[model samples]
Target: MRELHEHTTTTAADALGEAEVAVLPTGSVEQHGPALPLGTDLFAAAGVATRVDRADAIVLPGVPVGVSDHHRQFHGTLSTTEETFADYVADIVESVAAHGVRKVVVVNGHGGNTNALRRAARRLRADDVAFTVPWHWWDNLDDLIDARLDTSLGHADAVETSAMLHLTELVQEDLLADAEAGAADSWGREVPGGADVGFDTADFSDSGAVGHPTDGTAEIGAELVAEAVDDLNALVDWLAAQRFEDLRPAPHR
Candidate 1:
């Protein structure tokens, strides 16, 4: 694995100079019901990123906290303001850009950071810092989920539990029974017109879980991870071969 944390100064410098893109895993330290770990998002992000087969990309150390204020009602949930998180992410990308890395991919695991990451990507593009994109692992792995699991993205649910299972020992396996019992099945309650109302997890789920945790299995988790890695590998290859000048906006003649 081409990981920044494991590289020496000289080797890192050389690698950075030649790297086509740097992959930065960003996640949250938030509640994952009774069974999953607080670091579930981070673990998923880092695990997928590190497993990607990219010789020209460097997988940077993960940002283990994010905009998770919605989950703050749960214990062990740490969060940063959207502004703070976006700025921090922007700075990280800027730092890497300064090191001559023209392309950067923020492999994100937290849904809360979506808006913030989009804003950051826009800012980076406006400033011409680099071609930066925030890739949510769950968002990109819908097909895999459809094939391997019965549901989509859900907090501390089957998908997440399966990922934590793949991490080995990160999940509280003993508590899964309780977690499954408390799973909420949907994101939130919808109004008469089908519009979903926004609220904290405590307002809906008694156990802070939003899906079926019992549906998760380590075998499925491994498949999901492999699917993610393959997708990322293809993305990195495409990004590496693109010409920035051709992709940049053209001025009016």
Candidate 2:
């Protein structure tokens, strides 16, 4: 694994010089019901990032926290303000760019970080620091996911549980049955005469889980991981061969 955190300064300098893109896995530390670990997001992103077959890519250490304020009411969830998260992400990209890596790919595992990542990408473009892109692993594999299960992705649900089972040993398999039994089919509250409103996970699910956890399995998880890694590998290969100037903003009309 060519991880930035594991490399020596000299080795990193050499790797960066030869690398086309720096892959940074962004995840959140949040509750994943009773069956999965709180580090599910982090580990999922890191696992895929590390496994992708790209010799021209340098994988950075995973971001352990993100904009997860919605999950805060569920104990063990850590969060940062949206602004703070965006700033932190931008700073990381700028730092990597400083090392001469002109392209950066953020392998994101949390939905809450999407808007912040987009904002950060805008800032990077304005500053001409690097060509930055955020990729949500789930979004990239919708077809495969749909074929594997009828339910869409949800917090600590079948998708997440399966993913955690594949990527790490942190899942408490003994609790899977109970967790699945208590899982909710949907998120937040739906009103008859008003828009759906939700402040935290507690508002919708006492079990801290949305979706059917019973459907998850290590086999499905492995398949999901493989699909994501394949997609990411293709993206990196495409981006690595592009010219920076071509991707930069066009000259003012």
Highest lDDT model number: 2
True lDDT of residue 94, candidate 2: 94
lDDT of 2 by residue, 12-50 (tens): 888888889999999999988898999888889998899
Q: Which ten residues in a row have the lowest lDDT in candidate 2?
A: 193-202
lDDT of each: 0.87, 0.88
Those runs of model 2 whose alpha carbons end farther than 4 Å from true positions after fitting are none
For candidate 1, what is the lDDT?
Answer: 0.87
TM-score of candidate 2 against the unseen true structure:
0.96
- Residue 231 error, candidate 2, Å: 0.4
